[model samples]
Target: MKIVNAKEAGEQEIERLLTKAAFDQVELNPKIREANRKLFGRDMSAAELVRQIVRDVRNEGDKAVIHYTELIDRVRFTPEDFLVTEEEFQAAKDEADPDVVASLQKAAENVRRYHQEQKPKSWMTYRDAGSILGQAIIPLDRVGIYVPGGTAAYPSSVIMNAMPAVVAGVREIIMMVPPKNGKINPYVLVAARAAGIKKIYKIGGAQAIAAMAFGTETIPRVDKITGPGNIFVTLAKKEVYGHVDIDMLAGPSEILILADKTADPVYTAADMLSQAEHDPLASSIVITDDAGLAERVAKELEKQLADLPRREIAQASLDRNGLIVIAEDMRQALHFANVSAPEHMELLTEQPFQLLPYVRHAGAVFLGAYSPEPLGDYFAGPNHVLPTGGTARYYSVLNVETFMKRTSIISYTQPALSDVSSDIIRLAETEGLQAHANAIRLRRK
Candidate 1:
């Protein structure tokens, strides 16, 4: 990727580049708009497909689930053997490396500690007039977590996604992951067992989501679903939202670093590659005020790219979406960062604390070069399941709250009702809802 100086670029040129840098578009401005219009005009075929899957699984029960699992994941799993048995768990536990298991144990403890601080306590208050109001913080009855188990198996994902629900006092946590050639990954099975997951289902893709949302004969319905997946899996969550609560319709990963001359180019480049390696759509952007610093970071990116196991994917992502823009000052750099609202923001500068006040949006902010994105991804206490594709402007990282629901608690005494009756009737009458007005007025009478 070419290093561009933001201050030197003219208004039109900067605008064009910024527009191009955005993910919602690929081509020129007019072409990008046209493409968006075309995409939105199309039918909801994907949603329709999900609906059909939900209907079939709900009606046909375990039979349709097996059929879809075979058709989608290309794995044969009879209902009898779909659930992970005690023997399988023991074998997986025995198969996992001792050091790896120890690391997972430590990470799980950290995750639990961080999330436990987020737990909500129920509170109630009674007034002198005999009115009481308070909310009860209760975990969902059951929660389903979808972990990707294809070319890679993330035991860390299992720990991060399920531990919060477990700590929240969820009744049961059922984990669904695709099996490879009808066999689940030993490490994943070990992780699930270690995390205290009771039910592990050998199924994945949109089919698993449907079963979790609507419930089949074998897989029980869950009150909430949480985890990250591919595009198809994310779209499925969007479709099944009302059926069950979902964490978020997450997109590809992203990271934006605000670095200065004092920052380490090698560390910044390595962090960018960490996010880019997640997927081809991932973005790794660095905004700095020094042209020389930007060039060094780019060089470090090239050096680091050669060492990555997923270099092909990460290189493609950087070539397409990655950028190094040199700004006139740190303030200007931060302005662009806020506009991007990256899922991960690394403030790799001498004055990271000062910059923290300027950062208004981001899923999580990594304070210094030592605090890398992967720390939060696996070991750090905060959630790694973050909002991506600029959704950080509105959404937040997953936490214990994701697995819990809230209801407003409202109670009013006779005096309270009588005091507000006239104003309520006035507003209700203005809206032409006499029934609503009468509901309050009758209580007063």
Candidate 2:
């Protein structure tokens, strides 16, 4: 990790260090490009590949989904064999360690309880002349969550993505997990069951996204799609966005730690690795007032990297995207953090809560040394799915509101319409919208 002095580095240098390319600006990965060569007989950008895949699935339905899954994932299943059956659910439970399944059940319960508290109400108010105006909060009919096949397949994700829609009274919540061989991951299936999601389809990749977005003979079309995947999955989501809702154009995970003289070097280093292990693009940064603490934390990071199972990925992440900024003071540290607009902001200072009031942008804020990043990732009640790639400046954590839409309600008595008609007509005429003014005028006459 490069350690820089805030006084000499200046805002421009700091920005150069922190700013990542937008998700659309990223080029195709070489591995994915090579894979495309084998599949499509040519190398193409992620967008081109995703567009073809989406069009194929949208046009051909389940046949196209099966074709891609068999070729890419080396898994084959007929359209009838898509959805997870009750018998399959039982077998997954039987195969899984009871202790692990029990833990997921408890975690799902915590998720349910947390989301239950977040009921956005449909409300109204009485206005002058018996005019009633209000907003109605309505839930979507169906939602699909895409859980990846391998290490990224955290059962916690099932609860995190689905429970909010469930709490919002969504009629259907389905899940898609890429199958391994002929079966889905046992733990993921167990979590889906625990989260009260009945329908499970063992399909993944761009086809899985397309299947959900447009629906197939067997797969039900969802009102929205959530969860993360490889570049293809993200690009597929981008192409189908207007057809359905998406969580965000998610990018690499990131964490920005704001520390003071009172922060713990050991705890600080540990927290940094938590995000680093995710991907090589994942950023782990520290902004501190104390230069001494910076050196110790850097050394501590190297020491921890030696024993971690994912040391290679973590080390690459630190080497490429990590930083330690020696800010002049805590206020300066906070200023740099808000400017970066990180996905996860950790307050390792003496009073994290006091600092929280000044935090202008972040997907989620973890306060104090005790509240580590992993706590929010797993057992914590807050949603783990967050806006990344500095998009937190405008986006928000996946919450109950994501699955809902608000409709305005307007009712006016004759007196109420008359009271505002002249003003409305005048403003409409100023905008050169004669038809709009005529509508009000006709009602008045």
Best by lDDT: 2
Model 2 spans > 4 angstroms off: 22-28, 432-435
Q: For each candidate, how many residue pairs have backbone atoms clashing (under 3 Å)? A: 0, 0
The residue pairs that clash in candidate 2, if any, are none
RMSD of 2: 1.8
Q: How accurate is candidate 1 locally (lDDT)?
A: 0.83
lDDT of each: 0.83, 0.89
lDDT of 1 by residue, 1-445 (tens): 6577887774345435533433343223254345334544533445455666777877787898898788766777789977988888989888889999988889999999999999988888886567778888878899999999865789899998988888888999999998888878888887887789979999887788888998988889998888988755777788889989899887777888999999998898889899888777777889898889899999999998987899999998898878888988888888888877888899999979998998988999999878999999899889898887667878978888887777767788898777778999999999999999989888876
Cα lDDT for residue 307, model 2?
97
For model 2, how does the per-residue alpha-carbon lDDT over 385-423 read when each residue is reduced to its tens digit? 898888889998998888989999999998999999999
